[model samples]
Target: MDDIFHFDTLLAGPPDQLLKAQEQERQRIAADLHDALGPLLTLIRLELGRASELVREDDLSDLAVVIGRAHGHVAQAFDELRRTVVNLRPAMLDDLGILPTLGWLVREFERCGSGLRIRTDFAVTEQAVPSHLKITIFRICQEALNNIVRHAQASHAALSLTLTDESLCLAIDDDGCGMPDNSHRGRGPAGGTSSIPQRATSSGGRCDITSGPGLGTRIHVCWPLAGIRP
Candidate 1:
């Protein structure tokens, strides 16, 4: 009960503590994999290689082939684990900061070959964003883009992050076939879209979703600058 942040009431604790916990946990899990599973997987691959070599020297071609295949599978697993760790918590977010991380995220989606085009306009620089808000902004952008790519049939989308003297704002718009005003409005069957607003609220931000049957979708989220300080 002392963990101020609880989900039962749509974030009732301190302004953004729950999100901080979630992020810290992701970093922890990623580090654990890097420190533990990584070396174990490497050792497993080396052992399989040694077995393959021993079978080959014994003139047991079939056994050698089996051991070689096992080694290949182990190698593939090792690679996949590395990818999983990266997805858990991208290192660029910590090393290069949020701007580069956002750029990398956009580039990755573009490479997905979804035939969707996305444009970004950032009115604020890396230094302008509060440290506590960067990851929240990045995650909101990630979820919004995911929704556009998955549900919006239109090919063009735009993202903008800007800050005024008093508030910070993020907006995403798409040219796709928009949702009906009567629909769930980000609370529909799409869990991805639904989580966008939740994430904003968890960080003490307000989220707005606007769309009509054929008018496309627009998501706007904002926070008062004073409340977002770490």
Candidate 2:
């Protein structure tokens, strides 16, 4: 058994290899954004500025429509860029910790077309979690809330966080259509079961999804508190 374990270790290499690969991919994406998309956005901004100036000078009626369309396109491009950056890694989670960031997210979602009511309950204080753990919890909450908004058709949702002596728990619940199969676990279009679980595991946590035909879905996650840095 010892020899087999050693062989398996040799074949699998170190756990850090996966972390390194994820970091490398992150670096590659950052480089592409800076080198290619960044310059293209700058060029587009410059052209738009020049076109605005021309529209002002020409005073053509159709020029107003064209400039309006250009402005809308530019705004949309900026929104997409912002969304991409957030999805890559939420800056607010790193800067403000989980609670405040979650507050902001919930407020934003409430403002959207979905008339969902969100209730936030925090059993832990603001300083309860370390920075890394806070980020992890925040990301999980973001993912869960996003799923709710996209698929729930739910009228009400709740987000709750609790901390005990040994562990931290985060949960998001929605009163929308539940999962088709309570026993089966898989991913969905937005992010199937596999992806969400993988993310939670990567953050040293575990996630479980519970739902039924008429019963809404709830995502529950928990992580240990020992040695977690604030």
Candidate 3:
């Protein structure tokens, strides 16, 4: 499989060497969204609202209705763009920490009305889990649920996360059709499925995925907290 890096980047150095570069790219993307696109959209909405007021003040009431409609559309678009930005990098991750964010994710997914019920058990305390590990856990859960919704056709799913003095374990199970035989170990045959194991490994964890005919899929990951990277 192709790695996260391109040919030259992969040959150039170890994965640790590329982490800084990857983070820089993320910062650049954040700047583009926050500094460029976000302000421009806000400006457009402000100008539209201003125009609507000006048209009415100028005795152009007939045109005011049309301008008002355009302003409403722009308002809707602004709300949608803000949501997109939040999803790109959830602000709550920094503001509220990881525990609440995970809870919010579960609740939000349930509200999606996909007819999928996800039961969540969070036995681990926020203080017990490392900051870096929390992000990893959240990402894995997000991707696994996405895959289940898109492919499993399951009506019910369960997520369990627990921590011990030594390690943390997470598992997601579904009652849908199992994976194809070609999928092995913790990796599925589907393209998106590979990321689960890859993320676990990169975070110093072990992932186990099990499924078959008449058996729904289950993904289990265990990470020794002492060994987790910052």
lDDT of each: 0.69, 0.67, 0.69
The full ranking of all candidates by lDDT, starting with the best, is 1, 3, 2
Clashes of 3: 0
In candidate 1, what residue range of length 10 has the lowest lDDT sum? 1-10
RMSD of each: 7.9, 8.4, 7.1
The clash tally of candidate 1 reads 0
Q: Write the per-residue lDDT of candidate 3 for residues 1-230, one digit (tens) a residue.
A: 12111111112234453355457548866776676556556766676767767776895655666566666666766776677666665788778877788778888888887888999898988787787787788878887887777777788889988988788989898887766563343344222334566667677887777676446677888888777777
Measure candidate 3: CA RMSD.
Answer: 7.1
Per-residue accuracy of model 1 over 17-46 as CA lDDT, tens digit each: 545656766786778677766766766777
Clashes of 2: 6
Residue-by-residue lDDT tens digits, candidate 2, 147-202 = 77787678899999999888887888888876555233444212333234555566
Error of 3 at 211 (Å): 1.4
Total clashing pairs for each candidate: 0, 6, 0
Q: In model 1, which residue pairs have backbone atoms overlapping below 3 Å?
A: none
| Cα error, candidate 1, residue 200 (Å) | 0.7
